[model samples]
Every structure is written in C-alpha cells, then in structure tokens.
Target: MEERKQLKKTLKPHWVWAIAFGSAVGWGAFVLPGDWMAAAGPLGVILGFSIGALLMIVIAVSYGQLIQKLPVSGGEFAYAYFGFGRYHASFCGWFLTLGYMCIVALNASALALLIKFVLPGVAMQGLMYNIAGWDVYGGEVLVACIALITFAYLNIRGTSISGFMQFIFCLTLIAGLSLLVIAMILHPSSSFSNVQPLFNPEIGAVSAVIAIIAISPWAYVGFDNIPQAAEEFNFSPKKAFKLIVIALLCAAATYSLTIIATAVAMPWQSLIAQETVWGTGLVVENAYGTIGVILLSISLAMGIFTGLNGFYVATSRLLFAMGRAEILPRVFAKLHPKYETPFVGIIFTCLITLSAPFFGRQALLWVVDMSAIGVTIAYFYCCAVAYRLFSWTSTADTDVIVSPAKKAMTLLGLISSTGFFLLLVVPGSPGFLGTPSWIALFIWIAIGFVFFMMKRKDFARIPKEKLDYNIFGKTLESESISSNTTKKEA
Candidate 1:
C-alpha cells in the first residue's frame, strides 16, 4: 500500500487541460490547413472539421465513461485490460504505444521543419546523409535531438514541471491564435474572392470529409492524454470525465479556427502556389507583414513544444503502465524515487524519437499516418470494452454498469472508429495511406506480432499480483454513493 502511493497525484485541473488540449494541438494545426484547403475547399474544410468534431465527441464520451469507471494511468490500455485479459490488453497497449511514439517522432521532425522554414539556411545548410530521397541535415538532426532530450528531461523531472511548461505554451498558443484570427479579419489584403470553389471539385464533399476523418486521430490526439495521466490527477473521477470533454471541445476549436485563419490570411490559390510547403507562416506574414510572421513563428514553436511535451508525458505513462504489468519490460516501470517519474520509459521513448528526424519530415509524416491506424485500432478496442462492460454485470472486480445513454454513445464511438479504420485502409478510398506508409505500417505490425508471440508464455502465466493494478476498485465507491442517494430519497 505504501509503495502504491509512490506516484504523486499533483496534477490540477488546468494542468489536465494543458496536457490534453496541448497534445491534441500538434504540428497538424500549423502544416495541415493548406492540405485541408487543397483536399477540401474552405467550405469543405469547415464541414470536414465539423463532422470530425462530432466523431470526437462520441469517442470522448466513450472515454469519459470508461475513465470514470476506472481512472487509471494506462488510458486505452487500461480500458482493454478490463475488457479483455492480459494478452489482448498487451496487444492494445503495444499498438497504442506505436501511435504515441510516432507522434513524439512527428513532433521532433516538425520542430526541425518549423525551424527550417522560419530561419532559412539554418536547417538545410549543414548537409548530412540522405535517406529515402529526403536530405538529412546535421542542423535539422541537432534541433530534433535537442527537443527530444529536453522534453524527456522535463518529464523525467515530474508531471508538475512538465504540466507547468505545457500551460504556459498552451496559453501563448491560444492568445496567438486569437490575435491571428483578428488580424486576418482586419487586414484587407486577403480577398474574400480567394475562397472561390467552396467545395473541392476534385475530391467532392464526401471524400473531403472522409479525408479529414482519416486524419482525425492526429488532429485530435491530445484529449486522451488526460486519461493517460488519470492516476496523476488530484481530482474526482466525475471532474476528470468533465475535463476530458472540455479538452475535446477546446481541441476542436483550435483546429477549426486554425483552418479558418489560414484561409483568411491569404488567397488559397496564392498560398498553395508558394515553393515552400509552409503555407501557414506565409499566410500570416501576408496578413500583417514580417512582424506578424515572427509572432506566428513564435506561436508555432510554442504549439509544437506543447505537443512534444504532452506526448512525452503520455508515452512515458503508457510505457510505465505496460512495464508494471510486465507487458514489455519491468525496467520501464522503474520510477525515480525522488521525482516519482518514469525515467526509464521516458529515456527509451526519447531514444526512439531521436531516430525519426533522420528520415526527415515526409518520412515522419508516414509514421504519423501509420500511427493514426494504430490509434484507431486502440479506439475500437476501447469502445468494445465499453460495450462489453455496459452489458455485463461485473468486470475486473467492479460492479459498475454503463448507463443506457453512455451505452448509446459507446456504440456511436465504435461505429465512428470502424468507419475511420475502413476509410484509412480501404483501397480506392480517399483517406487511404499511401504505399510508403502502408509498408511502414506492415513492418510495425510484424514487429509487434513477434513481440507478442515471444511474450506469450509470460502472458499466459501472469502472476496474480500484476492483475491487482488493473482493477481500479472504483465501482464500490460508486455503488456506495448510489445506495446513499437511494436511502436519502426513501
């Protein structure tokens, strides 16, 4: 019992907001708006994000119910543990880990990409080896290395410090976004005539929405970070559930407004035609000139850092939970006694993230796309867990049953996740990952399969002790409250 209290429960409500909302806002917020404009015109992008937000609401509701029932550190992994036994839970955890790790890598690569765009020649000047047709520069790799190490260290220190950093950055990001939107509206340089052909004729509205849905996981990745740190929250389960919903709405606002701001900053035609891929910065510069671009760059850096920090926290917690459960290695569960942070897991994740920048941004994006598929699989499993628990009398020593309202939301979440997976993988589908991404996905899955098979013996004979952490024992408390309320009414 004393050792169980080792992890500090110090995260406040705002910290929860910072981690979840910050993680959800990522490099996609800065870079993907142009792609959104291209795939779906201004009208199409708006509709795409709107539908995407609805889908996220369903998933968030499902997650909220699950987290209230069992507020633990593993997030999706914990949901799977309660639904299916260790074997399947291990698979789910590993799959989700791949997704989080990819996001970490994606942020690292994005840092380099952002720097290169902001300060030209600084990133590309120091030429290094090339891989897969992308040039790997020493300057770029150096920036990524610094980011990876810095965030890992921050997380290693503790969630409180990391959350503090996240809060500052998130505050700055929101402020900057508001200012950008206002600037775009005031600046007459941007012509409303630029937003012609509301819906993209090439893809049509249906496919455009599907593309947005396909990339939805990356766009809104941070909301689940709240649940990933469920054990660290110094709040009630009900409050945690409510906060998760808030995080999702905040993320939706950030992405939607970002898209609108991009369109309003510059004509879509001129924005897309620039030789450089960074349409966001160019649009901002065009709106308010060089000073505006610099501010936008600063805001972008903070946004990227927030994402990097949030994912670092998430990946570490996930690996720590998996390690404690003996899914990967027990070493990953090791926490610094002084800091109570999962140092080993943090280091391991940092090392893995450092490798991605060498492949450059495009390759890193391939990882992000593949991660979307992985995360979607985990989402499906989580919804399945909700369904199983909703109909069952008991699970993982808990007597909680999902209410009908929550059950309906779970069903919707399941359906939405399934649709997303199909869109992502189906041939001739608008949202299909390209050949390179597919190859990467296959390799990652094969590795995970090999690990699972190797651990089958350990998984089969999993000791009773490890199972204890998986059962959160919240059902009894819930039952007590319900009984008290009933008695008072009588």
Candidate 2:
C-alpha cells in the first residue's frame, strides 16, 4: 500500500522554486491591486507585504525543519499527525483542503474574469442568472471549465510535464511583469508623485497596514506549497527553506511592483477610487493603449495558469494523503497506473472547481476570504508542531539537535499564525469575513464534520501502526509528540 501511494521524484529544484513563486504571484496580484490600494494605499501595500514576507520566512523555518523530517506529500497534514496524532491531523487536513481547493477554484473563476476584461461582450453571450449582484454567463462558465479541464489533464499526464511547464510559465510571468514595470517607468505621464497619500484616509495608516499584515497567510499561502511537493523534489529536501524564503521575497516584490506600477501609470487615489472592475487594466489601457493591455495579458495569463497548475497539485496531494489515511474515501488515494500521478485526487479537485464560474466573479471574493481562515488554521497547526519538535526537553531520541535561533523562529511563527487567525474571525477586523463568506465557511465545516462522522467507525478499526504506514510509509514510534495528552484518532 505504501509503495502504491508513493509519487514520482521528477521535480527539479528550479521547478520546485517555480511552483512556490509562480503559485504565490497569482491572479490576486494583478486583479486586486486596486482593491488593496483602496484598502491600504501603495506605500502601505509595499511595507505590509514586505513585513508579511519576513513573517512567512519565520514560518518557513518551521516548514523547512518539518519537511526535512517528514518529506511527504501532505506537508502540514503529515506534520500535524507526527506531532499530535490523528485528530489534529484531520483538523489540519480538512482546513488546508479548503485553502487549496478554494484557491484552485478562484483561479479558474479568475480566468473567466480575465476573458471578460479582455474580450468584453464575448463571454456575455448566455446570461445564466444573477449571483451576488454579478451576472452569471454560460460562455464564461464554459471557458472556465475548459481551462480547468486542460490544467487537470496537464497534471494527470505526469508531474514531469506539468513541472516543466510551471518553470516556463514562471519565466514568462517574471519577464512580462518586468516589462510592465519598465513601461510604467518610461511612460510620459507616469510619476511617483501620484502616490502622494500612503494610507487609506478613513482607516488611518497604522490600521490599513495592520489590515494588510493580517492577510499574510492568504497572500503568501503558496510558499507553504514547497512542502506539499517536497516529497517529489529531485534535489535535497534541506534546500526547501531557502527556496521558500526566496519565493516569498520574489512574490512580495512582484506584488509591490505590480501595485506601484498601477499607481505610477496614473494617480493612485483616482485609479483605485474609480468604479471599475479592472482598475489596473484600465490604467494600462488608458496610459499605453492596446499595447499595454497586451503586455498585461501575458502576465495575467501566466499568473492564472500557474495558480491553476500549482493549487491543483497541492489540493490533490492533500486529498491523496488523507485518503491513504482513510480519513477520506480510499478512491482519493489511487494514482494513475501509467503516469503515477494522483489522478483520482486530481479529477476530484477538477470536478469541484467546475462549479466555481457558475457562481459569478463576486462569489470568488467570498471563497478567497474564507480560504484565509482555512490556511491560517493550517499555519497554526504547522507552527505549533514545529515548536513542540524543537522544544522537546526529553533526552529520549534527542538526535534532532535544533539551535536556539531556529527555536525562536518557531515561537514567532506561532504568534504570527495566531494573529492571522484572529484577524479573520474577529468581528469588524480588517480581514473579517463578510456574511457570504461566513456562510460559505460554515457550510464547508459542516460538510467536513459529516464526513468525519460517517467514516468514524471504519477509521476506528484501523490499527495505529497500519495508519502510520499508510501516511508516512513507516511506523513513526520515534517521532514522539511532546503534548500532555496521548489521544489517538483513527
């Protein structure tokens, strides 16, 4: 069973870096810069993201340690199991599932939005219905479905193919974005003077920056993805930390540059304040005409493509991990006989993502808001696990000698992860969920509970040693937890 569950080891170091960087710099950077600027202004976005990246680097230290120890497909899911046994693993797995799937779905829906912005009236051919004050269109849904299917196939074909494509996409995306920033610099009308105000007036500078800081888990969610594919790395797993940090820095710079590029194209305040769906697109269109939009299109397409490709990989591996543990249906654990990819898991994710476009563009925000909560929950689990592993005082199995500095980083990771969680759930908080988002979040939690209950009996029957083999490929009796309780979950 363990052998059957193993995935191919074809992912190169550069390919791994591309997965993290490419996934982190997704549709959100291009499409939501104006919204971010409206919420926190240009300087706030820059400072907020830079600081957020630093915090994520702290978290990445925990991930690096855990990945070096476990080096599995489940990433945080396996880490949670190693630290606190099965129940906490379930909690981490279920929530991270939400984070990964929602991002995948969001990117697919974003593809439709990209089409709507680029081609305009073309996707409006068949008006399906009105959803969240946004019109649902059949043409848009079809386009999103096709894109989803194409990415799903690319993944199912083999990681060698998909991983190679991700590298190419990352290169093109960086080059295209570099061109956008350069064009903004040379444009006659573009000026740093436009970014005069650095804060949202209503919220104040401190509050606005804090708000952006709170969403760090969501913004830098994909860097954690390095661990998700760590098991597939063709290079040393020890290099995972450096790759994650490198990706976080690059992603932060990309986000800041994109926002600054938009602001410098015209007046920052006026561009963001305008009632336009695609404010950055409008800025480029007005300033540089079709040439600008065409340039923007390359970046946008690569962003969306990389997002779809990357998240699909993360979500599938997670489901595959959970399925192998029998927390989910065993079918999810199945792999393609030929490609050795997680085809069942891939197909399952694709099927779920297919419904996203039908909900219309506005619905994507609700999912995005809700996913922050999920990823933040997973972040807390990962950091907490790392803290225990490092701070374990028992001399038994003291082979893992962690430095004081590394231990301090894990503590900071815990604090920052907790802060991220509080921001999302706290009422009137900057990252608090709206009514629609709360509703979606609750429905997902309820479904997870239902699945847990239904599988409770079957899971209880599995022996702990067998469960360990299914998940980590061996019994982890040495991977002891430092917690007070020794409760085990099936």
Estimate TM-scores for all models. 0.92, 0.97
Instruction: In model 1, state the lDDT of residue 301.
Output: 84
The models' CA-based lDDT, in order, is 0.78, 0.86
How many clashing residue pairs, candidate 1? Answer: 1
Candidate 1's TM-score: 0.92
Evaluate candidate 1 by giving its C-alpha RMSD to the native, one decimal: 5.4
Cα lDDT of model 2 by residue, 1-490, tens digit: 4454788799999889999998988888999899899899888888899989998898888999999988888999988887787778888898899889889988988888888888868777799899889998888898899999999999999998888999999999999999999998789999988887878888989888988998888888898788888779888899999989889999999999898889887777888668799988999999889999999988999999999999988888899988888888889889898999999999999998898888887887787788888898888888988887764343555644556677788999999999988888999888787899999989989998998888778877887778788888887665557223244432
Q: Report the lDDT tens digits of candidate 1 across residue range 1-490.
A: 2133235788888988888888888767877788788887877877777778778878887787777777778888877766665666788888789999998888888888888887758888788877777888988889989999998988898888998999999899889888887787778776566677677778787777777767777678778888888888888866776776777777778777887778876668667777457788877876677888877777788878988999988988888888777787778878898898989989999998888888877777777787888788888987887765564233453445736777788888999999889988899887888888899889988998898899888766764333544334233323432334334433
Once fitted onto the true fold, the runs of candidate 2 whose alpha carbons sit more than 4 angstroms away are: 1-4, 392-402, 482-490
Clashing pairs in 1: 24-222
> Whose TM-score is greatest here?
2
